[model samples]
Target: MDPINKEGTPKTPTVIFDADKGKVEIRGRSIPENSIEFYKPLVDWLDRYADEAKGNTEVNIQLEYFNTSSSKCILDVFKKLEAVHKKEGREVVINWYYEEDDEDMLEAGEDYQSILKIPFKMIEIQE
Candidate 1:
């Protein structure tokens, strides 16, 4: 399937979902006017990718900030990935990147980890 690549803007994040490489990366800020609309295509793509996913899938999420609405959409994305792991039996790992001193971001990752069945690796990067 074709990949989903979107450039980041002041209010949106960059999204790169490559099925061939079994990798997905989301970075930057996400505060779009319509969070659901912004993430719908991604959810649809994951639905398709779930059936034909690789043995291993890696997701890197490095968002500096996201609003409440985006947070739910992000969780939806994670739920889709979780299905690939739980139902399809594929190995899925999510690398949640946060600044070294961004406790809130780290906590957000921890919250997601607690909610999802997929494995999550908390990665702290330099600010």
Candidate 2:
């Protein structure tokens, strides 16, 4: 499957979904006007990737800030990955990165970890 490479804009995040490497990265702010529309293709890509997923898929999410709508879309993305990990029995690892002083972002990652069954690595980066 072709990689999903989207440049990050002020209103959206940069998405790099590399099927060959079995790695997906989403970085930057996600406050798009239409969150669902912005994330539909990504969700679809994950669905397709599920079928041909490799041994372990790594998802790195480093978002500085995101709106409420984007939060739900992010959850949807996680759910898709969760299915790929559970039903397909493929190992899915999520590396959730946040700035060193951002408590909210850290809590958000914890929340996602609680909601999903996949393994999560909380990474703290210096600003």
Candidate 3:
């Protein structure tokens, strides 16, 4: 599916399944007006991809900020990944990237990582 596009305003965060790189990236601010609306299709896409998901599926989440609703949705997304890992035993890796020196973001990643059994890597990058 094509990435969701909105012009004349900031583009909504996107969850892109890159066929070439065999990776998925969810990047941007996620405090949309409707959290469900923003995340529904992406969740569905993850559900579909996880079924026949091929080789080293890397889920890259780099969000500058997200609301409480987005946090719940994020957990749901992680749960889905965990299920895929358990069910099919795929090489699922969750790379939670954040700006270097961003303690809040780093701590958030740690929180999720603790809950998920998948091999999660916290990546610190230049903002």
Candidate 4:
């Protein structure tokens, strides 16, 4: 999959999916005007990747903030990943990174961790 290039949303994050490396990284503010429009393709990409991804798969998320719609979409993304893990039994690692002062974001990750079985690693990223 081609890496998602940043398109003028300074605070908005970019997405990189490395098929060869079995890694995907999403980092940015996800409060897009049309959240679904932004995330649908990501969901599609992940779905396709899950089909062939083997051994280890890592999805690293570093979002400073997101809207309610974006939150729902993010949950969907994780759910899809969870399905891949359960069905394919892929070794998946989710590293959720938040700023040191962003307790709210960290807590959000914690909440997601509680709901999913995949290894959710909460990390503090220095701004």
Which numbered prediction scores highest in lDDT against the true structure? 1
lDDT of 4 by residue, 14-108 (tens): 87777678787888888877788888987888788777776677989988788887888888889878877786567778999989999999999
lDDT of each: 0.94, 0.94, 0.76, 0.81
TM of each candidate vs. truth: 0.97, 0.96, 0.84, 0.87
Candidate 1: how large is its RMSD?
A: 1.0
Clash count for each candidate, listed in order shown: 0, 0, 0, 1
Instruction: Output the lDDT of residue 117, model 3.
Output: 91
Per-residue CA lDDT of model 3 for 45-119, tens digit only, reads: 678767766666778888888778888888888887887777655778899999989999999999999888988
RMSD to the hidden true structure, all candidates: 1.0, 1.0, 2.8, 2.0
lDDT of 1 by residue, 1-127 (tens): 9999899999999999999999999999999989999999999999999998977899999999999999999999999999898865589999999999999999999999999888999999986
TM-score of 1: 0.97
Q: Output the lDDT of residue 105, model 3.
A: 92
Clashing pairs in 1: none
Tell me how far candidate 3 lies from the true structure as C-alpha RMSD in angstroms: 2.8
- Whole-model lDDT, candidate 1? 0.94
